[model samples]
Target: MNILMALSQLEVTGAEVYATQVGNTLAQRGHKVFYVSDTLNSPHQGQYFKLRFNKRSLPRRVWHVFYLIYLIFRYKIQLVHAHSRASGWSAYVACRLTNTPMITTVHGRQPVHRSRKKFHALGYHAVAVCENIARQIVRDLGVAESQVSVLRNGVDSQVFKPLAANHGAKPVIQIIGRLTGPKGQLVYQLLEQCIDLAANQVQVISGSQIDPIFDKFKTKVKFCGYSANIRQTISQADLVIGAGRVAMEALMCQKPVFAVGEANAIGLISVDNLASAMASNFGDVADGGKTELDIDYPQLAKQLRSALKQPKVDEEVYQIITEQYSLEKMTQRLLELYQSAYVYTKKREIPIIMYHRVIHNDPSQHGVYGTYVTLERLEQHFQTIQRMGLSPITFQQLDEIGLDHRFDHGKRYIILTFDDGFKDNYDLLLPLLKKYQFKAMIYAVTGTDHNRWDVEHPSKPDQRFELMSPQQLRDIDRSGYVEIGGHTVNHPKLASLSHAEQQHEIAYNKAQLESLLERPLYSFAYPYGDHNEQTKRLAKQAGYTYTVATDSGPVALHEDLQQIRRIVMFPSTTKFGLWRKIKGNYTIKKAAKPQTKNLS
Candidate 1:
């Protein structure tokens, strides 16, 4: 699968780091990844495009949308993952225009306003870094709870794990963050009140430039600007002070962390407050209704003093980080989300109604495997479909629509399919189809005119039915109401046959049908809806654009075109049952039921 990762930033951020790590993991797993961002700070394993996503000009935003659409089509991108609001806005519009699927990761708290609520571009799904951010997204942006997932930032334990302990006279305390905005203010406040300069050595690891206010403490505090190897700097520290991913990495290294962030302040992360600290992303996010950091200078000072003195290593912290916050675990979760979002965005919910034999007599007396529906019941089914304003379409038409990407969300369509090419389909079903001006596809077995397979079977030898003859199939093909498809020369379970046998059965029957009708067939049906991967490949090799099964397939229609799912219509089916089956949730509901034989 091709995936695009979009980020709107001028400098390296936690979101950028997260996206790069996940993208590299996906690339290693054979997925093609592409990056589009204002700047690339981390080493990415895929192609990168430089775009000014952080710029808010109207023309630049429109250009972003167009370029994204081009990338989606040119690369055949299956999904897009936007990491910030500025990029997500353009990505959302591009995805909507191209009918592509996208998801957004909300890395931090967003400002609440009317425009933010109304124009929130959180795509088909939103991933929040923590529970607090998830709640804020739902409450502030009006995104549904079901669409929001709370996934914390992952830490690479291999690089950040505990090294030899630093046993020094005075403990080394490190503060790691960008010295701007709320983080800069927090740094200043900590230096002025929380840190006891006489007892512990302080190191500030940030950018190259330093604020003038920090000059007063320059003599006492070490300003180590922008170390490329953060793990080395972290290894030298006895206690790390930061928030979000920094706190997680510190815990992975088996070092104590003083968690403070833009939103709030967590004095020290311990087993007692670990859950709360994780929920708020180590104090990078506030609880509901709180906008600023809740700080107590004297209390924080006391906690810091105690932590510096003890500097105890908690094994539980390391265990939790290794188990729940590992890079591999996070990458797997992200892959699941990408596939789900892709299905949600690209799937068409048109229900395909399956029938085997339409008889005039009472079906219960002769029905086996629920394959028969009475003529009266069939008419009633057609009436229900017409009353519900659903347009009946053939598999050929469906293929054309899918190829053109012209599915309209406002219109509803249902596929009426008849298996086995029974004589009753032409004798009893054609008149009703003509009366209603509906289209149907019938799968025909070209080698025989009778149900020899079923009649010869030991299970139910008494059950036998005549098949449509070659002339009858030709007449139906010319009727413009029904299309003919292949169902093999004999109705044998394809899965039971060898690969060569399956190939001969599928390809020979398709050839016979095309020769008889002087036209190509577009669809095929597996006998008994029984097939394996080899049989599916044979069907594709036979030139059928679509092949269908009874019930075993992916829920999304486009996910597995070779094994399209169909809803079996029983003799006892009512209008209400048909109505329920035609809805989008029927496949999901039926999946929960126990598996049964696919007699159709």
Candidate 2:
């Protein structure tokens, strides 16, 4: 497949390096690849588009967009991969013009602003380099979790391999990265402090040709500007201190990494701190001050002293880089993502069948017959779904397959979600689910013993239906076919509650359910399908991978997971009606607002 890679700039930043590595690798794999950037110093062999976007005005950007279209047409580019935000915008327009698939890899710690919505508008699949950025995209930027993938940056282990530990009278400690921005001051301070050490013992590798900040400590440390042989420089150092790609490279070199950059000190990289280090990309994107390092110098000094004494890299640390942080793994994952980007790029209209109470005697006697489906009708719905070749998938499965884009289009997916955790769901729904070999997700109201939230329903007042007991929830959860989710503690109107109250209701219910089942809960259903912006934020803060609402119609691939749309089923509904909804062609009248309370 022909691919176009666009980067905002060709600077020696981690993002640029990542794009170069992946683009070159794709070319080597016999794919027609084109690399374009604002400034290109080193060129790749296959193809190059030396388009500069730096400080570009509106007209220039528009022209660049047209140029991108020309390139896409000339090369038959099937996919466009953008690296930085500016390039993302241009590529987004180009892809739209050419009707090609596009993917973005976010490398910087971008602030969550209103502009992030453009990613959705442009139909750009997002790839976050770290978990923190992924969470930010979902919670702060309002991107759906299913629309983003967390694929961390990787290092070329073959090029950046372990060298024997440097054990000499004076340890050579090095810091590598572009010495500008907020980190320059910290680098200056580090160099000044290291003046007491012999000049040969301290080394700095960066892209800045000449800076006043480093001029003061020129004689104290060897300041090499933009060396092509960075791996050799890093290999010679006894200890390497940096962040992001540099830290990963140091770890691959089997040199102990201090991971101090961007004003945050992540301390020594070891097995114990590996998870946290990897989460923030080793302090490259830490939560700290705007201008200078937020590190405690005295403590850093102590750690540095200890690090200098113990320059030997831990075997586990070496293994972590070799196994998980290799360039091959990252390239393969990107290749898979690039090839499968089309699976979820467009929305899929899959009906999420909503159920509350599946009872035996529910022909017409039930006060709330809308939510009350007879066992026979339930069987018929399942049979229709099965006969139609639709697979009933749990929310977890949908997330895994859709976000990862690892499913085939031959089989369609439908979600069976039961809200309010009725006892009949366990007694009646469980057997049919097991017998029909279908999977369903049940959202429980943890605080209430009965369906009191529905007591004040306009049609059915003072209803006292028993909710599933904790043990019953545990039972169905143990069954491999059923997954448990949260539906707020008291089932109150989340939009009406204060943010704190909403958080407690949503998060507390999740905590209680997880405690009861002894497993993590990732899906949540808003009570009564009532939620505001605060409700969505709290659901994410509560740690739900996705949430569902009572909104009508089939769920889409790009629909917010926090408000997954569902098709409410009534007793009067038939197999044909179900088929229409599943086919994304039906529009049933929404059930009464208050009816949502009692049904759950």
Name the Cα RMSD for model 2. 11.9
1-600 per-residue lDDT for model 1 (tens digits): 688999988766789888998898878876788999998888789999999987889999999999999998888777899999899999999999998889898899988999989988888778888889989988988977878888778777777778666898888999998887778888999999999887889999986368898889998999998776788888889899999888888888888888998887776788878888888889899978898876888888888888776576677866876787888888776766665565456753678889988888764436455578889999999999999889998888887765223233245788999998999999999999999999999999977888888778787664678899889999998999999999999889999999988988899999999999999999999998999999988888888888999988876665567998899998889999998898656886666422211111
Instruction: Judge candidate 1 at residue 270 and give its lDDT.
Output: 82
Cα lDDT, all candidates = 0.83, 0.75
Range of the 10 consecutive residues with the lowest summed lDDT in candidate 1: 591-600
Q: Any runs in candidate 2 off by more than 4 Å, and if so which?
A: 117-123, 287-292, 343-600
- The C-alpha TM-scores of every prediction are 0.64, 0.57
